[model samples]
Target: MDPRLFLADLEAKPAALRNLASILTVGDAWAGLPAPVDRVLLLGMGSSRYAAEMAALRLRAAGLDAVAEYASTDASWPPGPRTLVVAISASGTSQETLDAASGYAGSAPLVALTNVPDSPLARVADLVVPMHGGTEEGGVACRTFQHTLVLLLDLAARLSGEPRDVASLARRAADATEDLLARRDEWLPTVADLLDGRHGVYTLAPAERLSSALQSALMVREGPRRPAAGCETGDWSHVDVYLTRTLDYRALLLPGSRYDRPALDWLRSRAATVVAVGADVAEAAAVVRYPGDDDPYVRLLTETLVAELVAARWWAAAF
Candidate 1:
């Protein structure tokens, strides 16, 4: 694999998001909801599912009752006609998402968000929001995932009556990523060396940064053809910590909350190879530095861009 194709795809996200802002405007996309919506259900698969989860959190924080569910989960069906159902699919060809959309035919007006405007999901949607991430032939949804998160954030901001200038944020994201790519010599060598000898990877983050961890894990799995795990910090401690005792795992931490410390400490004690992003940890094998700004939303794009590089590094070493 020519790694340039993948990195180029990742590098295009800023422009992709800028294009997305010019193309999509929230219409009466939420018309099906009552004057005061009590709940919303978002459905998607894979990276799209991670976007849904992030959007759901933003919506909930904006005072709406929202939850994200996997498109393939039978339990994700709307509770009633009152709850708005949002089906998100990057490819628009995900069978599970299509099936969910079909199941909710007339339950309520369905909103579809996707990269391919003409995908089957868009064809049936009451409102179609395009990702505008451009064509991706790298076989991974790099720009598409970032654009999906932007669209969902834009939608949530509109719903909350506090719309933002997404284009401006996108420009900043582009600048941040371009800076990192330009200075790859500083951090890439250390991060890549720690990952090179690992059997596989497991990424953990507080719920606050789980989306980045998920995207990172996705990149590692897809780009390097290696097994990757994404887990909530606290929960992984209770149930899956036993796996750490059994295996010498390479773990990546997307740190945001102090609550992540205990899990990081436990992983370190077990001889796990730990890499921390966004913060330096003395216990970690390496720390991939990210911006220290308090705004995690802006940090998301930059940090995930780092994940893309991590995957690309693994690709270079493996092939």
Candidate 2:
């Protein structure tokens, strides 16, 4: 993957998001999905799975029986007429997803969510929904990842019969992303230094928006080849708290979790360096803020730009 191209891919996020919003305003890409789905099964891997899991959580909260499973799994929910299987892959060629989707070919209603309309996965589905994130010359899933989350939010709204203006949310997220890109000169260097510890980068986010943490950590690892890990804010106390005691733990905290206070408490006691993104946290060594951050959906869609940009910077430096 070319680091320069990755940076350019990131630079184009605002415009990409705006285009998606405009497209969403005109029509529903999910029109072909069968109605009265009794169970929703989302199948994907890596970034696709991350977004799918979050979408499934929202669906469950809305009282729909939904689950997101790793496409590599050997067994999953049995295919049935009332089941809707959404197989997501930005390139529409993820082998594992294609294999998993194949099992439900005739037994269940299948939908393919992909950027490439003519890809193999699209050929396998009864209906194909385009990602519309355009191309990522960077050879990474930056904009596609963002678009997937936004589209999944729309999917959740439709399935749950929840009235949400997702197009408006996409526009807001675009504004927030633009704000961050324009102001990067002011905050990027500080965040880069704070998180440039030797051990690795740790990302934490609320369970509601855990994909932010997962995608952020993935960016650091995928782009810069750095070691990074993501953890849920509340689960940090049990899982990642020990690292702070021995290592020079440096972390990115995507605030908003009610459980944040306890995790921050441990970070403070251990003198761990923390960079708070989207919201201000007094314990953090630095805070990165952008427009429309007050909206949780905006944060969910936009906060990862911080880690992505940092990964881009480090990746570029290496080359």
Candidate 3:
């Protein structure tokens, strides 16, 4: 299937997010825990793990005590009561996630967010949040990752007793996704042109956009068949910046909360080609602006959609 068509199919994300929210809310009701659960544990790997991190932040903002652990790491440790384990896997069959779920002998309830309800993770979960990305090709997760992030944001809101607000925010995110998809033909070609001959790429972002950067790097690797790495903006400023100058690398900056204007200017001064993907572009070599509220979660979803479409365009042009 063509990559554009595959990306267009991501429009089902809103409904998918709503369905997952309903399931989680109903499960919370049915679980009938003496009180709202206080502690939460999230587990996954790769982009799935990145989604867990974003979910942890949203959960924390919503007043729930949440933490994320890579599935491999979580599998090595046992969970305890009063903890809710949320497992995320785009394919629902991630080996590490499945192993973690099976190894978790603790009494805490398990919730799964996945595209396949019948897959291993779902089978072991006490509650399953089904993703709307029906099927994927080329082994790269574009739509699935975006949808999972949206669902997790909604899940966090639901758990925080703000279901209505979460739904509203999701709708806006879905709208932003649609807008980017509509204009993909124009922006993606530019992205493809920018990344044309680069043998390697690096994605930079703050903690909030860390997942976006990771997903962007994965898209470049899987879709464009390029070597890509992602690093936090703050950390990269200290260590990776010198390496980037040494390598004369092209950087894709998914500016997060920690984005320092002076640092970005300095990188530009070093002649690094920095492409900014987000609402406002500052001193970027190229910019792919996504329309949406400034909420990191919402912007992250929009940015991922735009970046994936651009990567898909590159993939199509290459192959």
Candidate 4:
């Protein structure tokens, strides 16, 4: 069971995402509640949690009142009636998310975005947003995660009363995926060569790319057959930098504002084999660069495709 096959499978299912637009169109009625929502509480864990983080950022940027918290946090301190809880889980059966949904005290509506529509998360949600990607065999997320985030963003845009051209966005995102898949042969071999026999891997990024770091770690672990970890740029320097000398690890840095550039440079100087995504790679071990759109939502979609390409290469070589 070569995991790289999963990437190929994902590429074949590019229309899986376009199908989500229809799902959202049918589910759009949920966006038109009698009263506008006062706040949104997004809950999930691991990659699902990261998806919520990305969605929360988009919602905030659209001036939609929203916040993302771990399902455990939500379970401990639930929100009130004015809140809408959007629970995201690829496997729909994540215990923490289910438990949080069950335990939420508020009269607020519950929305679930999941690949497994029959699972418990969907059963509990007032409205279910089904992701088109099928089951993900490996523990890491690939197409499932990508579709989940995009669908959530689509829903957020519709609900926030923002002018989101879903058809245009979906088409562009699909095109980006196609572009990366086309170039897989060129970059895969290089990534595989660089990551061959590597023991530890670390991904660093700021803000939006922070979710990319988390997704990268999962892809390497589940797809590339490696033990991996991820962190924010400043946090990595303060906490994980010391471990570089003791443990053999590869670091991939995503460039952010000027604040992240200095830290990224320092990490590179420390002899960490850094790979840059969505930015220029200078003396880095490998670079998976993509043309990103100015829209944060679009940039996130592009970054995800780059990560998938890198993960597929590593998986082909290592697994």
lDDT of 3 by residue, 106-219 (tens): 466787878888888888877777766667654567667877776777666667876445545556676777676667677777775665545577888788768988888888
Ranking by lDDT: 2, 1, 3, 4
lDDT of each: 0.76, 0.96, 0.71, 0.70
User: Which residue segments of model 2 deviate by more than 4 Å?
Assistant: none
What is the C-alpha RMSD, rounded to one decimal, of candidate 2?
0.6
> TM-score of predicted model 1?
0.88
Give each model a TM-score.
0.88, 0.99, 0.85, 0.85
What is the Å distance of residue 216 in model 3 from its true position? 0.6
Report residue 214 deviation for candidate 3 (angstroms). Answer: 0.5
Cα lDDT tens digits, model 2, 60-118, are 99999999999999999999999999999999999999999999998999999999999
Q: lDDT score, residue 32, model 4?
A: 36
Best candidate, TM-score:
2
- Which residue pairs does candidate 3 place in steric collision? none
Q: Report the C-alpha displacement of residue 73, candidate 1, in angstroms.
A: 2.2
* Tens digit of per-residue lDDT, candidate 1, span 70-163: 8898865454656777889988989999888878767766778887889999888766777778888677888888887777777787777776
lDDT tens per residue, model 4, 227-285? 87878787776887786776556776666644566666666667667666666667677
Q: Which candidate is the best by lDDT?
A: 2
lDDT score of residue 286 within candidate 3: 70
Candidate 1 residue 125 Cα shift, in angstroms, is 0.5
Local lDDT at 206 for model 4: 74
